[model samples]
Target: MQLKQELIQQIQSIIATAKERAIRSVDTERVLMYWQIGQVIQEEEQQGKERAGYGEFLIKSLSETLQPQFGSGFSVRQLEMCRQFYRTFPNTNALRSQFSWTHYRTLIRIENQDKREFYIAEAAKNNWTARQLERQVNSQLFERLLLSNDVKEVLAVARDEKQPSDAKEIIKDPMVLEFLGLKREAAYYEKDLEAAIITHLQEFLLEIGNGFSFVARQKRIHIEGDEFSIDLVFYNRLLQCFVLFEIKTTKLTHQDIGQLQMYVNYYDRFEKQEFENPTIGILLCADKNDAVVKITLPENNKTIIASKYQLYLPTEQQLIDEVKKEIEKLDHDKMNE
Candidate 1:
């Protein structure tokens, strides 16, 4: 009976693999077909003798004729999208077979070529689904990273031209936790927030970015007869170190920073292996004062980071304003120097 069950399980796995491949093959063909259609439309527009208003009329007429026989997928909007797909990715070789039409549509909408390219590379590397790609784009993940790092180097890492050597490359500030279903105005205990995070561990992991796996919660530690509990602990395989997190329900303070530093020291001295990198400490709080953080940490400090957590997603304008403020501060400091 055991042998029969093993044989049946193997057959089921084989069938599942074949089915997935078949779906992927069909999706790739559809993507290619759309690109081809866009190419033809672009060529026709270029060849037309009268350029003014000709493109609109061509798309309308084509859509009317095609929609009748080929269905609504050939609507003017879709044709325009196809044309944009080709325009955004002019070289056919640049298109990946793994990406579906949904992915291309999302990519083509990004106006900045560099940011678009970064998203494409990240999506492919992370194997992000269409919805996941959309979420990251909407969240302005690229802009957030640019706040602290060089754009050229970040893009190079995204494109696989360079590698990230530290945890800072993967961590994002003000991580959005709207998916946790926590009320923004509601006052909750750190334990409650920790519970929510564990309940939505999958979503939390996704929000935390790649290479992180949850290790423990309320992890107890004893040092010199003093006991302490860590809010959360994670291991980042890419950085090859333990990641320690502490949750604060209010604005970060010097004491909070010091306490986290102590935990980090404990891990570095006792928990971490000699081969492992130094443990990275993150303080997730409701608010963060950059000036406070700068003043509290040593000038050479790199292991500890304090980031804000938001219960809701900020509006697009809010993100833009924040970026502008950051840039202006940098410029002001340079002028003062």
Candidate 2:
């Protein structure tokens, strides 16, 4: 019996090692291929005196010839991607050996270099699959970071080895709640939205951003015979903090902020460990007045955040304009300061 157990263990160990080695080998080979493809495209472009059209023509010709011999991957679009792949990562040695070609395909589509680099580092560090990377990108991860921080802080968080420390790092504003199937104009109570979120909790968490895990809903608290129930509670592994949320179907009031503050204080005093940071409170409301929130909270309040929730996805242009306006307002405030 002992001998059989040992043999089985040995086989398992061998299989694990073989799988690890195989993955590494595949990664290395793919990285090398990308580098070589980049090199070939760069050389051809230079030969043609760096004319843009020359590269396109070369890809067209190459695709026509190579597709028959190599099957599906040699399409003109892919060849163009190879050229872009080289342009994006001019340093072959800098290519992350951990990610596959599909990962690069997603990264190359991100036009912002800083955002692209951030995704690359994160994807490699987290060992994220191509699909995960796609989801993160589609969720506007870069824009969320930018909204929460300055350019320097955003870049540092993206590139540095340290985990993000701020509450805003984990909080996503205007969180996509499309999975709830709630109509924007439809009149619904807070309970309806809360129920929908609970039903589609996993998708909601992804929309909420990284490091969030649901803890409880309508968590009952009793203190001195007075009872209170929080709408939702979550723990963020990345921020190492407990996040408390309050849902509101109407425009947020100062009273709502005060109530959330009380919840935050209670959690900090009783629930949070000494090692963990103070609990964060978020008011997820249909509408919020930035001026009211600023006045209601302490001057240096980091634990409390107010976010507006939308039932439906806004048009891309509308989102862009809103972001632009916010940036302008921030800049104006900075100037006054």
Candidate 3:
């Protein structure tokens, strides 16, 4: 009976694996077929003597002809997308097999080549589904990273051509917490915000950037009969350090900075192993004044970071403003030096 059960389990595993492989094979072939159709359409369009609106006419006619034969996938919009896909990825070798048509559709919408490539590399490395990839794109992960570092170097790290040596590479300044289901206008306590983060811990981790795993919540520590409870604790494998987070529902102040710094010192002194890097502390706040943060921390400080959390996504103008502020802060720091 035991031998029979084992045989059945092994056969089931084999069937499941084979089915997954077959689906992947079909998807890959379908992607290639679309690419080929796109190529033919582009070639014929280029050869046409009539230049004005000829391409549009061609796509429309082709969509009408193919829709009857190939069904809804050959709609005008899809055909146009396929054409744009070929234009964006001129070389067939550059197309990644792991990406489905939906993934490419999202990728092609990105106007910046470097940003597009970065997302592709990151999505592939992280094994993000189409929906996940779309979310990352909408959140403007590339733009947020560029807020604190050189674009060229950041792109290099995204491509895995270089490794991150500091926490800045793994952290975003203003994290979007739209998934937390919180209202911006609603008054909430620090503990409430912390609870939301804990409830949506997976999304929070993803928003915090990669390589982080949740450790503890309201972690208790004692010093000289005084008790302190840290809001959240995480371990970052890439940085090989314990990442501590303090939740602040209101605007950040010097006291908040000092508290986070103290927590960081405690971790480094007692919790962190000598082989690991120093613990990094983050104050996740609703608002922060950059000047106050700069004045509070030591001139050479790298341990504590204060980042704002937003309940909703920022508009394009808001993103631009954020970037400008970041650049100005960097300039101000340079001048102070």
Write model 2 residue lDDT over 65-176, tens digit each, in one string: 9999988777888778888888888887787777788898999898888888788876775678888788777766667666667766666765665678887765767665
What's the count of clashing pairs in each model shown? Answer: 0, 0, 0
Mind giving the per-residue lDDT tens digits that candidate 3 earns over 44-119? 9999837899899999999899899989999999988888888999899998888987888899999898899899
- lDDT of model 3, residue 290: 84
Return the TM-score for each candidate structure: 0.94, 0.84, 0.95
Candidate 2 minimal-lDDT segment of 10 residues:
310-319
Model 1 scores a TM of 0.94
Off by over 4 Å in 1: 1-3, 332-337
Ranking 1 against 2 by TM-score, winner: 1
**Candidate with better TM-score, 1 vs 3:** 3
lDDT, candidates in the order shown = 0.89, 0.82, 0.89
Off by over 4 Å in 2: 1-28, 50-52, 161-165, 179-187, 311-316, 331-337
